[model samples]
Target chain A: MLTVEKVSKEIDGKKIVNHVSFQIKQGECVGIIGPNGAGKSTIVSLISGLEKPTGGEISLSNRPISSWGVKKLAQQMAVLTQDGLNPYPISVFDAVLMGRYPHLSFFQREGKKDYDKVEEVLETVGLTDLKDQMLDTLSGGERQRVAIAKAMVQEPSLLILDEPTTFLDIGYQLNILSIVKDWQRKDDLTILMVLHDLNLAAQFCDRLILMDEGEIVKIGSSEEILQEDLLSKVYHTKPEIVRHPKWDIPQILLHYE
Target chain B: MSKKLFQRDRMLWLWIPIFLIILLIVMSVSVSLGAASVDWKTVWKIVFSKIPYVGDWVTADWSDSAETIIWDIRFPRVVLGAIVGAALALAGAIYQGVLRNPLADPYILGVSSGASFGAALVIVFGWQLFGVGRFTLPAVAFIFGFTTLMIVYLLARVQNKVRLETIILAGVVVQAFIGACLSLILALSNEQLQTIIFWMMGSLSLTDWSYTAVVFPIVIVGAILSLFFIKDINMLGLGEEVAHHSGVSVQRTRFLLLILASVITGAAVSVSGAIGFVGLVVPHIIRLLFGSNYRMILPLSIIGGAIFLVGADAVARTILAPRELPLGIITAFLGAPFFGYLLRRAKREYF
Candidate 1:
């Protein structure tokens, strides 16, 4: 479980994340949805300890996040930011192996245990065949899967992905979301992800947090938070919520200007 | 059935020949062929005499003058060239990794200009302010070089993160300012002007066994230290956020790398007087061959860089015969065209 209490972040006297508070329970897949510049990424950064909050505390598993060393924090939580794309031509295996960095010591090589774990993660992410392939050769979808594999290799309690499917195609997006959902169910992993697609978030996420201009407007189950009126109010656009015939999930339809 | 094993086996085989051929060609031709036209036999004699037990068989027919020329003069210069080359390349690789910019060189921190100014000050005043025994000029150069780099690094660092553009701009500005200072010293100095001028132009002529003795340990230590940080450097190449998430102290690692690289650049410049392009070119060539893996690239750069500068030095010595060209000039001449070709190739490939 992760709890963020009254977290606020300011840069040069301008508030980026303002008085944001949220709690994520164990095994819950929470989605943060907002338009561009809505401070969704900022919240992820704060949660991942990339940026410190000006006012408030974040705790994981009832312990203060600040008490955790970087490696300890990494062991508990793995974050894959939108800019996780590496320009270097590294092999996929090596790229995923980087996730084990926090677990390994400076002088230690990747031992049998490390390689075994990596092999397991490669299989989990469906990238076992592409392990030896160069990252540059992989497609955008394959790259995101590789990123997810990297995070999974950490075996963290919480997985935080900021805009993981922003550049991916619909099939790839579904593939990633399904994979996350499957992992959440099987491993009981806590996931907090940012998504631009309201429909995808509504379908895949157990809970949804709606944010607008650095503040969370609402947080609840997708059915409660994905109301047409609330989304219209938050996004300043008309959105229709329809029931999914099979899954009983809310489906969102946005009306363009 | 064993296709996967075959692929892995082939990959290993591919690198072995490529690495060995380049290593061999660069080492043999660079060391054996030189300006003095000394036969391979004499060169062997001179080299073997330095070995404790094997001296007699090789040096039986060698004269004292020949031995002195080979052992004291040419040998030290070659060794210094190799050390400086390795240092420069190592520094270049680190800077590129830290900045995530392929074009970044060791001079990005303004160490070269700082060392040059230090040398200028020593040459003009003929005084060693640092009080370093024996090798005062180089010691002074190193001190100023390291100082200038620290200053530049500090100026470039804003809110802890060192912005690539800021570092590059600071380096250029500080370099210009130091160049003016050097000019001022040149204008004021009356005595030892010729020596000052020659040194400023950059030379390997001043190299001796004593200079080599002083720099060898520092370069070796710096190179070895860099090798240990290859993994950290690899992480850094991915950018600060990724590195941090991977549990690397990004800022501290970057700072240490910069200082170590500066020490290398300073030490090399102190002895070789700002020999350019070896740092810029050698690492690029190594990367082209070895891929971007720092684990392989760093060690290969050390050996490859040594071979490169030794070859360049040999060419510099032999090409002009009796009239020796400055080693800096030779490197620049070779480096500029190679740099242009690389730039064109990179543009075509990446842009």
Candidate 2:
């Protein structure tokens, strides 16, 4: 459903994302995993159309991403960055309802259907009770959930989460990832996420695109990519690979000394 | 849809009519007040007598002097105060939303200093347009205000990208430079100093129907235009990236909003010299009472500002009797403390 053909981005004479190419089939959950400064977030930014690639083209549905109107692209894709939304003095319901902005005309007010969709998304994110509360009053986890609810209400076919669980606690991290996983399963949604936690990336993502130093090192399933030698070389850390106790997935365990 | 989603509509019903009624009462009482002190009954009768077809129905029971005072002088001055107040408040709200900063006011983009510099220059030279003597000052001030905004816009842009912080800094730099020039002029021109200084302090006393005529339509049209962008303003408050992610054209919306706000501000400042605090504080008062949704804040600000300024101008006119206080003094004196109290008592973040 999405294609990135040798996309590269440069900033101030530095190649931030150097000729990275990848594609995700429809209904696929792809995670871009890397250590710090791996250009993972840069790749997400390019694909979400937040930033333009200097060298190559990125397209969605066979059309160049630049050719799509901002609103039309938004109707098809939603992007959520880490702590992107601020604590404005707006209610959760009102904040989520803003997601329907692209669907409406300039003078049109949010109608009954738009309001209903916001309400439904709020329920899905388990924020129905906190709908009336102001965003500043909510905790970080709650606010992040509200952001996801907002994205869900946009009704986008492709959702981009850039370190969505970066600021959450362990329980909240699982809570957020599970919500996205359930959403992907139910809606046949295509997800492109940048994940910092390797174990969670292995658990949630169907395919991992391992990036190192502005280049894609490998792209394969967790069993193929999450090997001790490959990760040690790319991350510059001693690592051990093991299987999850509950689920039969490749997991990483770091070794000190 | 949940009943909570309809709360904004219901609150609009409750608050708009209430504020409109308050505005009418303020307008009537302000018209009846001042040195001559016509009664409210005479004020209405004179007002009715001035209306075209309605004038024939009403008998002229009041004296010609009362009619002139009520219709010609006090009525237009009060209306002008309302227009200037609404314009400043609406512009202030727009600036705050666009910049995503609660402290932003209408004059944040050097519009006030630019217009003031233009006014001071005119006062110093005693320059007048040949056919339209009175229009020259306002026209020059309005043009200067718009030009200053353009300069600020251009200075803020770096390689075609305009940052919000850069825009504010640019505005301050321009204002400071122009302010130095103003002080130099004030220091040198002895006789015109008082006129320039008083104009800076702001007053509604010099305005007539003609001044009101020029400002009223611009402010009204600007306020109506502003409504179309309220949703975009709300989205922008979240942050530029979030706004872009939600399909708002961030740069274009900000540019249009800033221009719309500055235009209204220029028109108001041309008529009434930079009246302070009404623009800076009225939106906060509305947000304090109501929520931060621009849909409610924008409309409420237009009326709320009108009420606050008309009431303040009335006080400025009457408090010290024949010797009137500057309207800016009253707005600042009253608005600052009230805003401080609201800020301290606010349970949530106002911004």
Candidate 3:
């Protein structure tokens, strides 16, 4: 569904993403994992077309990124970013309804169809009780769920998650991923998630793309990419890779020097 | 249970329309109280006569001077007040949403202080460019106000990209510089100083149909442009990425809306001096009752602002009788306290 060919992005004399290329197949769950400043978010931003690549090309379904005006591109993909939601006080329903904005024309308000979709989404996300409550009143976990529900309501082919579980507790981290995992299965949703926790990435993603210094270090199934030597070398940290006893997925364990 | 409450909420929506009608009634009452002391019935007769089908039903018994007084003199000022009020409030609401800051006002772009300088120059020097005479001050005021906005906008831009915080900060800096210059100008000029000082305080006292005629089209056109982007503006509070992901052209919407909002504020300040408090308070006040939805906030604030300012102008005219209080004083005094009360009561509901 998406392709990046030697895509590079530079800003103010610094190469944030350099000579990186990857293809994401339809219905595949992919994770981009890297240490801080490994250009994880920037790469996500580039793929989302929120930021333009300084060189090379990114194409969605065979069309170049530049050709997709923001409105058209938005209908094709939804993004959940780590950046704080604006602190403007708004109700949960109103926040979720905003996801339907791209679908509505200029000056056209959300109609019965839009509200019906929002009601179903709120129920799916377990926020029906809090629908009328202000978003500012929501807990971190609830806010993240609301954000996810917002993305879900977009009904896009591609869903991008940037640090989807950052600032969340372990319990919430598991919960958010489970929701994503379920939706990916249900909708055949193509997810490109940026995860900081290597273990979570290994557990949830079908494949992992390990990155370092604005370049891709490895791209393969989690079992292949989460190898101890490659992760330790790329992350500059000693690490141990273990398999889940039942699930048999690769999980990374960091060690103190 | 919540669905029941939602239905009740639908019932409560009638309150805004009813309140708007009350505002119209108050405006009618206000025209009667100012200077001439005409009765409400007489005022309505003149008002009704101007309407197409209603003219024959209107008694047409009112005097010619009374007709001129109500229709020509007082009616225009009230309508201008409503226009200025609506313009300022909508500008405030848009600024607050785009900047994602509740405290942001239309004057955050330095329009007020810039207009002050222009009005000050006219009052102090007694110079009327192009022999425009009295219109010179407002024309210069609009030009200077617009220029300040452009300067702030430019300073906030880096490589042709503008950040919301940068522009707001730039406006603060420009306001301070222009404010100092204005004070210096006021201090140096001794005669006709009250004219400048009082105008700085802002008044609708100078309003006439010509002022209203010139400003109405500009404000209405600006308002129409703003309305076209209502959906985009509603998404702005989600922040740039989320708004963009929702299909809003963030930077473009912000740029166009900023210009549109500036048009409302600059044109308003040009005609009405620099009324404050109404823009900042009216939107917040409306949001308390209506929730933070821009759909509700936009129209409610426009009407609510018109009501508030015209109400304030009414009190400004009749509170002391014969001599008028500056419109800003009444707005700040009345609006700020009312807003404080609403804020205290609805702290959790503020959107």
Candidate models: Cα lDDT each: 0.79, 0.90, 0.85
Q: What share of the reference contacts survives in each candidate? A: 0.44, 0.72, 0.82
Q: Candidate 2 lDDT, tens digit per residue, B1-351?
A: 111232364578788999999999999999999888899988988888778999899998888898888888899999999999999999999999998877799999999999999999999998897876879999989989999999999999997788999999999999999899989999999888888888998989888899987888899899999998988999998888898999998888899999999999999998889999999999988888777888788999999999999999999999999899999999999999999998887765667
lDDT of 1 by residue, B1-351 (tens): 101121222354465566557755554455565544455567766787778888766636867776676777777887787788888888888888777777788887788888888888877766855567657888888889999988888888888887677888888888889888888887887886777777765677767888888888999999888877877887776667877777787778888888998998888888888877888888887665446667667777777777778778878877877778877788889877976776565532221
Alpha-carbon shift of residue B92 in model 3 (angstroms): 1.2
Consecutive 10-residue window with the lowest summed lDDT within model 1 chain B: B1-10
- Name the runs in model 3 displaced over 4 angstroms: A254-257, B1-15, B125-134, B347-351
Candidate 1 C-alpha lDDT tens digits along A1-257: 99999999999998888999999999988999987788999998888888889999999998888788777888888887775657566667777777888887767656778778889989987899998776666788898888788888888889998888888889998998888788788889999999999888988888899998889988998888988888878777888788889988889876676
Better of 1 and 2 by DockQ: 2
What are the root-mean-square deviations of the candidates from the true structure over C-alphas? 3.5, 2.3, 2.8
Docking class of 3: medium
User: What pairs collide in candidate 1?
Assistant: B35-B318
The estimated TM-scores of all candidates read 0.92, 0.97, 0.93
Q: What DockQ, on C-alphas, does every prediction get?
A: 0.51, 0.69, 0.61
